[model samples]
Target chain A: MLDAAIVLANFVVIPALSYGSLLALGALGVTLVYAVLRFANFAHGDTMSVATMMAIYCTWWLQSLGIDFIRPLPTALLAIPFAALGTVGLLLVIDRLVYRHYRQAKAPPITLVIVSVGVMLILHGLSRMIIGVDEQRFFDGGRFIVSAGEFKEWSGLKEGLAIKSTQVIAIVSAVTLMAYLFYFLQRTRTGKAMRAFADNEELALLSGIRPQKIVTSCWILVAVLAAVSGTVYGLDKVYKPFTYFQLLLPIFAAAVVGGMGSPVGAILGGYLIAFSEIGLTYAFKRVAGHLLPPSWVPDGLLQLISTDYKFAVSFTILVAVLLLRPTGLFRGQAS
Target chain B: MSGRDRVYFVLCLLLIIGVGIFQSWNVALTMINFALISAILSLGLNIQWGFGGLFNVGIMGFVALGGLAVVVVSAPPVEEAWRAGGWRVLSALFVAVLAIGGSLFVWKRWRPKKYGAVSLVVFLTMAFVLYRFLFDPAVLAIEKVNPALSGFLGGFNLPVLLAWPVGGLLAAAAAMMIGHIALGLRSDYLAIATLAIAEVLVAILKHEEWLTRGVKNVTGLPRPVPYEVDLQQSIWFQEWASQLGIDGIEASSLTVKLCYMVLLIIVLALIFTLCQRALNSPWGRMMRAIRDNERAASVMGKDVKRRHLQIFVLGSAVFGIAGAMMTTLDGQFIPSSYQPLRFTFLIWIMVIVGGSGNNWGAVLGGLLIWFLWIQVEPIGLATIDFLTKPLHPTSPLRVHLIDSAAHMRYVMMGLFLLLVLRFRPQGLIPER
Candidate 1:
C-alpha cells in the first residue's frame, strides 16, 4: 500500500499539481481577457512566451552579475516582476496602437479574434527572433526538495517519493497569487470596477466606471499572470517558443471548460485538464506491479492512452464540453 | 468586372512578369503553380467566411487529408504487410464500430431507462478490451514486416489523378463531422474548436503509421505529369528542347511544371466559375443575408445552421482538392509539412487581403500573398545586406540580422494584416 501510494504520489500527483498551477495561471489570464475585452485573445500564449523570454534574459543577466543570494532558489522569481512590467507596457502599447481603434469602432468580437490571430503571428515571430527557436534550460538552484534516495533512507521504504523544488515553488506561488487576486477582487474598488465592467459593460459605464482604466488594470493583471506562469513553467520544464504556442489549446480549453469569464472556474478547469491529461496518458504498470499480487500481474502496460495522444485527450474533453454545455461548466455568459 | 478590377488584374500580371524577368521563368512558373493552389484554398475560405460568415480554421487538417488521399489512392500496397495482418486489422475495426453502434442502439431503445448509461459504459469498456485483444497483435505483426522500409499497410495502386476528387470526398466527410459538432458555436469559440480539431487530425496522421506511414513520409507517389527524368530520356523531348534552344534537363523540368500548371488551371477555373455563379445566385444572396444578419435571417425562415454546415463542408472540400494537387505536384506526401501557419492562417490572410465575399478577390489575394510569403525572406535578407555593407565581413550585427531575416515574413505578414484590417477592413477588392 505504501509503495503504491508513493509511486502514485511521485508520478501522478506531484507532476499534476505543478502543471495544474502553471495552467491555472495561464487560464486565468485568458479568462480575464475574455471577460473584460470580449475576445478570446489568441495571442495570450505568445504573450506569455515573450514575457518569459524577457524573464529568462534577465535571469541570465542576474547570473552573470554573480548574484549568490538566490543561489538556493531559481532566479526567475526575482526577474518576474521586471518581466511583468515589460509585458504590461508592451500590451498597453499594443492596445493603444491596434486594439483601441477596433474597440472604439465596436467591431464584432469575431473581428477582434481575427485581429488577435494577426497579433499572435507577430508575437510568435518576435519571440522566435529573440530566442532563436532553440530550447533553453535556465534552471539553477536546488534540484529537488525531497530527494528520492533521502526519502527511501528516511522512510525505510522500497518506493521513494521525489519532489522537485520547482514543483514546490510553482504550487506555493500559484496559490499565493490566486489568494491575492481573489482578495483584491472581493475587497478593492478597482477590482470591483473591473468585475462590474466584465459582468455588464453598459451597466458599468452607466454607473460611472471608467472603461479605459478597467481595461488597463485588466491588462496589467493578465501580464503579471502571463509572466509568472510562463517563467514557472519554463523553470519546471524547458523554454521552447513552439511549446508555449501549443499550450494555447489546453489553456483555452481550461478557460472555456471552467467557464470563460470566471476566475474560480479557470483555476478548477486548469487542474481538471492537467490531472486528466497526465492521468490518462500515464502507464500504470509500476503502480499496478506494486498493488497487485504477482500471480495476477498483467503482461501489458496498462495505459489508457499513449503519451503521443495527450493532445487528443484535451481535444476530446474540449469537444465533449462544447457539445454538451456550450456555456461551460460554470455557466458563463452565453454568446 | 469594373475598370478598377481590370487594373488590379493587369497589375497582378505585371508582377508575375516582373518575377519572370527578375528571377527566372522557372521560378515564376513554380510560383504561379503554388499561387494557383493557394487561390483555390482561399476561394474555399471565402465561401465559408465571406459568403456564409462561418469561421473555419481547420484548413490544415482538410489539406492534410487531401494529401493522405493521394497516398491512399495512388501508392502501391505493401503486399506482404497486407498478408500479415490486414484482415485481422479490418475485423478489429469492424468489431469496434459494431460495438459503438450497438451501445448507441441500447441507449436509444433499451427498456431499462435507469440502466442505460451504465449499460452503455459497460458495453463500451468490454468492446474496448475486445478491440485491443484483436487489434494490438495485428498491428505488431504488420509493423514488424520489414520494419525499415514498408512496415505498415500501404495504399491502393491506382492512377494518382483520381485522388483529387477522392481527397475532396474524404475532407468533406471529416468536415461534416466537425461542422455538426462545432457550427453552433460563437465565432471565437468556433475558431478555437476548429483549431483544436485540426491539431487532433494532424496528430492522428502523425501517429497512425499504418494509415499514413506517419512522419517517415510517403515519397515517390505517382504523379499526374510525366517524370522529368523520363521526359529528359525521350528523343521527342530532346528535339523539343533543342528546337526551343534550351537544355534537355531544364526543358524537361519546365515541361513537367507546365503540365502541372495546366492541370491546376483547369481545377481552378472550374471552381472559380462555380463560386462566381453561386455568389451571384439567389442561394448566394440568401447566404450573404444570413451572414449579415443571422437573427433577421432566422426570423425570415432560413436554416442558418444547416447553411453554415453546407458552406463549411464545401470549403473543406476545396481545401482537400488543393491539398491533393499540392501532393501530386511534389510527388510526395509529408505529413509534417502541413503546419497551421503555412497551411491555415496564411490562407486566411490571403482571403482577408484578397477581399472576402468576392471570388476574384480571393484568387488575387491567394496569388499576391503567396508571392509575398515566398519572396519576403529574400527581400529582407537583401535589405539587411545592403544596409550592413559598411560592416566588417564577420560583424555580429550583420550576421544576426541575416540570420533573423528568415522570420521577417511572419512579422511582415502580421503587420500587413493589421494595417489592412485597420485602414480598409473591406479588403483590396470589396464585395459588390
Candidate 2:
C-alpha cells in the first residue's frame, strides 16, 4: 500500500501539481485578457514564448556577468524581474501598435480575436528569428531536491521519488504570485477599478475610473503572469517555441473550463486538466497490485490510453463542460 | 466584376506571366496549382467569415480530414492486414457507437429517472467491456502484420479523383458535428471549440497509425493526372517536345503539370462561379442580413444558429475538397505537416487581404499572397544582404540575418495583415 502511494505520488501527483501551477499562471493571463479585452487572446501563448525568450537571454547575460547569487536556485529566478519589466514594455508596445486601434474603434470581439491572431504570427516569427527553433535548456544550480537513488536509500522503499527543485520552485512561486494577485484584486483600489471596468466598462467609466489606467494595469499584470509562467514552464521542461504554441490549447482549456474570466476557476481548472491528463496516461498496475487481491490483479499495464493522446484529455473535459455548463464550471462575468 | 476587380485580375495575370518568363514554366505551373488550391480554401473560409460572420480557426482539421479521405478512398486495401483483424475492428467501433447511442436514447426516453439511469449505466458498462475485449486484441493483431510495411486496412482502391467529393462530404460531416456543439453560444466559444477540435483531428490522424500510418506517411498516392515518366516514354510526346525545342523530360513534366493545372482550373472555376451566383441570390442577401444584424435576424425568426451551421458545414466541405486536391498534387498523406499557421491563418490572411464577402477577392488574394509567400524569402535575403553590406563579410550578425531570411514572411505577412485590417478592412476588393 505504501509502495502504491509512493508510485502515485511520484508519477502522477507531483508532476500534475507542477504542471497545473504552470497552466494556472498561463490561464490567469488568458482569463484576464478575456475579461478586459472581451476576446480570447490567441497570441497569449506566443507572448509567453517571447517572455520566456527574454528570460532566457537575461539568464545568459547574468551568467556572463558571473552573477550566480542564487546558487541553489536557477539564475532564472533572479532574471525574472528584469524579464517581467521587459515583457511589460513589449506588451505595452504591442497594445499601442495593434490592439489600441481596434479597442478604440469599438470593434466586435471576433474582429479583435482575429487581430490577436495577427499579433500571434508576428510574435511567433520574431521569437523564432531571434532564438531559432530548437529546444534550449537553461536550468542551473541544483537538479533535484531528492534524487531517486537517494530517496530509495533514505526511505528503504522499492518505489523511489525524485523530487525536482524546479518543480518545487514553480509551485511555490506560482502560489506566492497567485496569493499576491488575489490580495491585489480584493484589497487594492486599482484592482477594484480594473474589475469594475471588466465587469461593465460604461459603469466603471461613469464612476470615474480612468479606462486607460485600468487597461494599462491589466496589460501589465498579464505581462507579468506571462513572463513568470513561461519562465517556470521553461525551467520545469525546456524552452521550445513550438511547444509554447501547443500550450495554447491547454491554457485556453483551463481558462474556458474554469470560466473564461474567473481567476479562481482558472486555477482549479488547471489542476483538473493536469490530473486527468496525467492519471489517464499513467499505468496503474502497481497501484492496483497494492489495492486488489492477488487473484483480482490485472495482467495488463492497465493504462487508460496512450500518452500520445494525452492532449485529448483536456479537450474531452472541455467539451463535456461546454455541453453541461456552457458558462464553464464557474459562473463567470460573461455567460 | 468592377473595373478595379478587373485590374486586380490583370495584375495577377501579369505576375504569373512574369514567373513563367523568369523562373521557367515548371515553377509557374507549381505556383498556379498551389495558388488555385489556396483560392479554394480562401473561398471556403470566406463563406464562413465573409458571408456568415462565423469565426472558424479549424481549417487545418477539415483539410486533414479531406487528406485522410484521399488515402482511405484511393489506396488499395491490404488483404493480409484486413484478414487479420479488420472485421473485428469494425465491429468494435460499431458496438461502441451503438452503446453511446443506446444510452443516449434511454436517457432521453426515461427522463433521467432511476431505472433509466441504471439501465444506461449497465448497458454502457457491458458495451464498453465487449468493445475492449474485441478491439484491443484485434488492434494488436492488425498492428503486428507486416509492421514495417502494411500493418492495417488501407482503402477502397477507387480512382483518386473520386476522393475529392468524398473528402468534402467527410469534412461537411465533421463540421456539422463540431458546429452543432459550438454554435448558438458567444462567438469566441466557437473559435475556441473549433481550435480544440482541429488539434484533436490532427492528433487522431497523427497517432492512429492504423488509419494514416502515423508519421511513416502514406506516399505515392495514385494520381488523377498521367505520370511524367509515362509521358516521357511516349513517342508523340518526344516529337512535340522536339518541335517546341524543349527537352523531353522538361516537356513531359510540364505536360503533366498542365494536366493537373487544367483539372484544378476547372474545379476552381466551378467553385468561383457557384459562389458568385450564391452571393447574388436572395439566399446570399439573407445571409448578409443575418451577418449584419444577428439579433434582428433572430427576432425575425430566421433560425440564425441553424443557418450558421449550414454555412459552417458548407465552408468546411470546400476546405476538405481543397485538402484532397492538395494531397493529390503532392501524392502523399503527411499528417504531421498540417500546421495551423500555413493551412489556417495564411488562408485567413488571403481572405482578409483579398477581400472577404467576394469570390474574385479570394482568388486574387490567393494568387498575390501565394506569390509573395513564395518570393518573400528571396526578396528578404537580397534586401538584408544589401542592408548589411557595411558589416564585415563574415560578421555573425550578417550571417544570422541572411540565414533567417525565410522567417521574414511571417513578419511581413503579419504586418501586411495588420496594415490591411487597419486601413482597408474591406480588403482590396470591396463587396458590391
Candidate 3:
C-alpha cells in the first residue's frame, strides 16, 4: 500500500499539483480578462509566452551582471517582478493601441476575439523574433528539493519520492498570488469597482466606477499573474513559444470548467484539468503491478489513452462540460 | 462590377503578374494555385460568417477531413493488412458507434430516473471495455503486417479527381455532427468549441497512423495530370517545348501545372458562380435578414438555428473541396502540415481583409493576402539585409536582425489584420 501510494504520489500527485498551479495562474488571468472585458482574450497564451520570455531575458541579464542569491531557487523568481512590470507596460500599450478602440466602439465580443487572435499572432511572432524558436532552460539553482535516493535512505521505503525545487516554488507562489488576488477582490475598493463593472458595466458606470481605471488595474493584475505563471511554468517544464501556445487549450479548458469569470472556479478547474490530463494519459502498469496479485497482473501498459492524446483528453473534458453545462461547473456568467 | 471593384480585381491580377515578372513563372503559378485554394476557403468562411453570422473557427479540421478523403479515395488498398484485421477493426468501430447510439437511446427512451442513469453508465462502460478488447488486438494484427511499406489499411484505388467531391461529402458529414452539437452555443463559445474540434481532428490525424499513415505521410498520390517526368520523356512534349521556345523540363512541368490550373479554375468558377447566385437569391436575402437580427428573424419564423446549420455545412463542404485540391496539387497528404495558422486563421484573415459580405471581396482578399503571406518573408529579409549592410558581416546585431526578419511576416500580417479591423472593419470592399 505504501509502495503504491508512493508511486501514485510521485507520478500523478506532484506533477499535477505543479501543473495545476501553473494552469490556475493562467486561468485566473484569462478569467479576470473575460470578466472585466466581456470578451475572451485569445491572445492570453501568447501574452503569457511574452511575459515568460521577458522573465527569461531578465534572468539571463541578471546572471550576466553576476547577481546570484538563494542558491536553491532559480534566479527567475527574482526577475519575475521586473518581467511582470514590463508585461504590464506592454499590455497597457496594446490596450491603448488595439483593444481600446474596439472597447469604445462597443464592437461585438466575437470581433474582439478575432482582434485578440491578431494580437496573439503579433505577440507570437515578436516572442519568436526576440528569443528565437529554440527551447530555453533557465533554472539554475538546486535541482531537487528531495532526491529519490535521499528519500529512500530516510524513509526506508521500496519506492522513493522525488520533488523538484521548482515545483515547491511554483505551488507556494501561485497560492500566495491567488490569496492576494482573492483578498484584493473581496476587500479593496478598486477591486470591488472592477468586479462591479464586470458584473454590470452600465450600473457600475452609473455608480461612479471609472472604466479606464478598472481596465488599467485589470491589465496590471493580469500582467503580474501571466508573468509569474509563465515563469513558473517555464521553470517547472521548459520554455518554448510553441508550448505556451499549446498551453492555451488546457488553460481555456480550466477557465471554462471552473466557470469563466470566477476566480475560485478557475483554480478548481485548473486542478481538475491538470489531473484528468495527466491521470488519463499516464500508464498505470507500474502501480498496477505493485498493487495487484501476480496472477491478475495485466499484460499491457494499462494507459487509458496515449500521451500523444493528452490534448484530446482536455478537449474531450471541455466539450463534455460545454455540452452538459454551458455555464460551467461553478456557474459563472450565463451566456 | 463597379469601377472600384474592377480596379481592385486588376490590382490583384497585376500583383500576380508582378510575381511572374520578378520571380519565375513557376513560382507565380504555384502562388496562383494556392491563392485559388485560399479564395475557396475564404468563400466558405464568408458564407458561414457573412451570410449566416456563424463563427466557425474549425476550418482546419474540415480541411484535414478533405485531405483524408483524398487518401481514402485515391491510395491503393493494402490487401494483406486489410485481410489481417480489417474486418475485425471495422466490427470494432461498428460496436463503438452502436454503443454510443445505444446509450443515447436508453437515456432518451428509459423513464425510470435512477435505473436509466445507472443503466446508461453501465452500458457505456461495457461498450468501452468491449471496444478496447476487440480494437487493441485487431490494431496490433493489422499494424504488424508489413510495418515498413503498408502497415495500415489504405484507400480504394480510384480516379484522384473523384476525391475532391468525396472530400466535400466527408467534410459535410463532419460539419453536420459539429454543427448539431455546437450551433446552439453562444457566439464566443461556438468559436472556442469549433477551435477545440479542429484541434482534436488534427490531433487524431497526426496520431492515428492506421488511418492517415500518421506523420510518415502519404506521398506520390496519383494525379489527374500526366507526370512531368513522363511528359518530358515523350517526343510530342519535346516538339511542343521547341515550338514554345522553352526548355523541355520547364515546358513539361509548366504544362502539368497549367493542367492543374485549368481544373482548379473550373472548380473555382463553378463555386464562385453558385455563391454569387446564392447571394442574389431570396434565400440569400433571408439569410442576411437572419444574420442582421437573429431575434427578429426567429420571431418571424426564420428557423435561425436550421439556417445556421445549413450554411455551416455548405461552407465546410467548400473547405473540404479546397483541401482535396491542395492535396492533389501537392501530390502528397502530410497530416502534420495542417496547422491552425496556415489552414484556419490565415483563411479567416483573408475573409476579413477581402470583404465579409462580398463574394468578390473574399476572392480578392484570398488572392491579395496569400500573395502577401508568401512574399512578405523575402521582402522582410531583403529589407533587413539592406539596412544592416553598414554593420560588419559577423556582427551579432546584424545576424540577429536578419534572423528575426524571417518572423516579420507574422507580425506584419497581424498588424495588417488589426489595421484593417480598426480603419475599415467592413474590409476592402464593404457590402453593398
Candidate 4:
C-alpha cells in the first residue's frame, strides 16, 4: 500500500507540482498585466514562447562553445537570464510602438482587447516566421539523477518512484521567484507604488506616481516571469509555438478563476486548474483497487474521463466559477 | 455630390480599376465576391459592436453554424446512411437535450434539501449511459453504410438559395441561446465565453463525422452562378466575346466572373439598404444609446439586456448569410478550413478600418480591406524575392527569409490596425 502511494506520489503529485509551479509563473505574468494594464494581454502566451525559443537557441549556441553544465539540470537554465532580458526589451518595444497609442487614447477595454488580438497575431506570426511551426526539444542533457528503481529499492518497497532532477529544480526556482516577488511587493516602495497604482490608477496618478515607470516596470517583471515560465515548461514538455498560443485559454482561465488582479489568487488558481486537469483525467483503477475490496469495485467506472477532454474540464470549471461568482472568489474588479 | 464624396468615390474607382489591371479580371471579381461577403459580416458586427457595444468573440462559431445550415438545407439526403444510424444519432441528441432540460427544471423547481447535490450526479449518470448507448452503435452503423461517399446522414434536397436565410436563422438561434446566458456578464467575460464556445462548436463539427463528415469536408456545394467552363462552352458567350473584340476563352471566364460579381453586389445592395434603414430606425437609436451608456439606457427603461440580445441575433444572422455565400463561392463546406485567425480578424479589420456605425462605411471597409489582404501576400513575396535575388538559389538564409515573408502579411495587418486606431480612430468614412 505504502509502495503504491509512493509511486503515485512520484508520478502524479510530483509532476503536478512542477506543472503547478510553471503555471503559477505564467499566471503571475497574466495577473500582473491585468492589474497594471487593466486588460487581458492575450499575446503574453506567444511572447513567452518566443522568449523560450530564443533561450533554447542561445543555449545551443553556448553549448557549442563548450560551456557545458556537469549537473543533470538542462543548460537552458543558464540561458534563461539572457532570455528574460531579451523578452524585456521585446515587450518594451511592443509597448512603445503598438500599445502606447491605445493607452494614450484611452480606448475602451474591448478595443484594447482587439488591439491585443492584433498584437497576438503579430507575435504569433513573428514566432512562427522565425522558428517555423515545429516542436523543438533542445533541452535534453544527462539522464535521471535519481531513477525510480533506486528510490523503490532504497525504501524496500514493491512500487518504484521516479523524480526527475529537472522537476526538483523547477519547483525550487518557482518557489524562490515567487517568494522574491511577494517580498518585493510587500516590502518595497516601488512594489507598493505598483499596488497603489493597480488599486486605483487615477488616484495613483494624482499622488504623483509616474504611470510610465510603473507600466514599464510591470511589463519587465511580466516579461521575466513569462520567459522563466516558458523555459521551464518547454524544458519539462516540448515547445511548440502554436500550442503556447492555444494555452492562452487555460492560463487566462486560471488567472480569472482566481481573481484577475490578485497575485496570490493567480497562484492558487493555477494549482487548482492543474490539479483538476490531472486529477480528473487520471484513472483511479489502481488506487481504487488498493483501497476497496475485490468484489465491491466497479469495472470501468474508475476512470473519471479521458484526458482528451482535459481542456473541457478547465473550461467547465471556469464557467462554473463565472456563473457562481462573477467577481471571482477574491473580488477583484471585473475587466 | 459634395467635392469630398466625389473625390473619395474617384479614389475608390481608381483603386478598383488598378486592382483589376494588376490582377486578372476573374481574380478581381473573386476578391469582390469575398469583399461583399465580408461586408455582410462586418455589417453584422457593426450592429452588435457599433450599435449595441456587445463584445462577441465567437463570430467564428456563428459562421460555422451558418455553414452547417447550408449543409442541412441543400445537400441531398443520404437515405442509406440515415437508415443505418439516423435513429441512433437522433436518440443520442434527444437524451442529451432531455438530460440538460431535466436538470435545469430540477434545479429551478425543486426546494428539497440536498437536491442540488444529487441532481447533477443523476443528470450526469443518465447522460453518460444514454450517450454511450446511442453513440457507440451509431458509429458502427455509420461505418457500415457507405463508409466513404455518404457515411453519415446528409441534408435536405432543397434549392440552395434557401440556405442563406436558413443559415442566418440557425446562427441567430444559437446566438440567442448563448447571449441569453452570457449577456448579463461583463464584456471581458463575454469575450472569453464566446471564444471558448466557438472553439467548442468547431470541435463538435470536426469530431461529429456523422453530421459534418468530420475532416473529410463536404464539397461541390451548389453555386448561384454558372461555372466558367460552362460559360466557355456556350455558343452565345463565344459570339458575344468575339463581338467585343476579345479572346473567347478569356471573355467567357471574365463574363462568368462578372456575373458572380453582379450577383454578390445585388446581395450587398439589398443587405446594405436593409441595414441602413434599421440603423436609422428608433430601435437603432435605442441601441446606440445603450452602447454609449448601458446604465443610463437601462435606467430609462430601455430593457438593455433584450436590446443587446436583439442586436446579437441580428448580427449573427448577417454572419450566417455571409458564411453561406462564402461556402457557396468555394463550392464546399470544409469545416476544417474555417479558422478564427483568418475569418475573425479579417472581419474585425474591415469593421475597424471602414468605420463602424455606418453601413456604407462597413461595406467600403470590407471591400478595401479584403483587397489589401489578398494583395499583401503577393507584394510581400515580391519584395522578398527582390531582396534575395543576390543570394544563391539553394542558400538557407534566402530560403528561410523568403518563406518567412509570408507571415509579414499579419504584421502588416497589425500595423494597419494600429495605425488606423491611432491616426484615424474614426475610420475612412466616419459616421455622420
Worst 10 residues of 2 chain B by lDDT: B111-120
Q: Give the per-residue lDDT of model 3 (tens digit) for B185-236.
A: 8888888889899999999999877777788888878999999899989999
Q: How high is the CA lDDT of each candidate model? A: 0.91, 0.91, 0.92, 0.81
lDDT of 4 at B2: 42
lDDT (10s digit) by residue, model 4, range A1-335: 78558756865788888888887888889889889988878787888888988898888988898787654567888899999999999999999988888788887777788788888878888887888878998776755667878977787876777777678777888899899899988899889999999999999999999999999999999988988888888887888988888778778778878878899988888888888888887877776666678897767645566665667777777777877887777887784
User: Ten residues in a row with the worst lDDT in model 2 chain A?
Assistant: A326-335
Q: Candidates' DockQ values? A: 0.80, 0.72, 0.81, 0.53
The CA-based lDDT of model 1 is what?
0.91
User: Which fraction of the native contacts appears in each prediction?
Assistant: 0.66, 0.54, 0.71, 0.43
lDDT tens digits by residue: candidate 2, A272-302: 9999999999999989988889899988888
Question: Of models 1 and 4, which has the larger DockQ?
Answer: 1
Write down the worst ten-residue block by lDDT for model 4 chain B. B1-10
TM-score of each predicted structure versus truth: 0.98, 0.98, 0.99, 0.92
TM-score of chain A of each: 0.99, 0.98, 0.99, 0.96
lDDT of 1 by residue, A1-335 (tens): 89999999999999999999999999999999999999999899999999999999999998898885977898888889999999999999999999999999999999999899899999999988777788998899899989999999999999999999999999998999999999888899999999999999999999999999999999999999999999999999999988998889999998888888899989998999999999999999989999999888898889898798888887888888899898888987659
Tens-place lDDT per residue, model 3, A1-335, is: 78888999999999999999999999999999999998888899999999999999999999998888767678898999999999999999999999999999998898999999899989999998989889999999999999899999999988999999999999999999999999999999999999899999999999898999999999999999999999999999999998998899899999988889999999999999999999999999889878999889889899989899988888888899999999988988758
After superposing candidate 1, which stretches have Cα over 4 Å from the reference? Answer: B110-112
> lDDT of model 1 at residue A216?
94
Deviation in Å, model 3, residue A329 alpha carbon: 1.0
Summed backbone clashes in each candidate are 0, 0, 0, 0
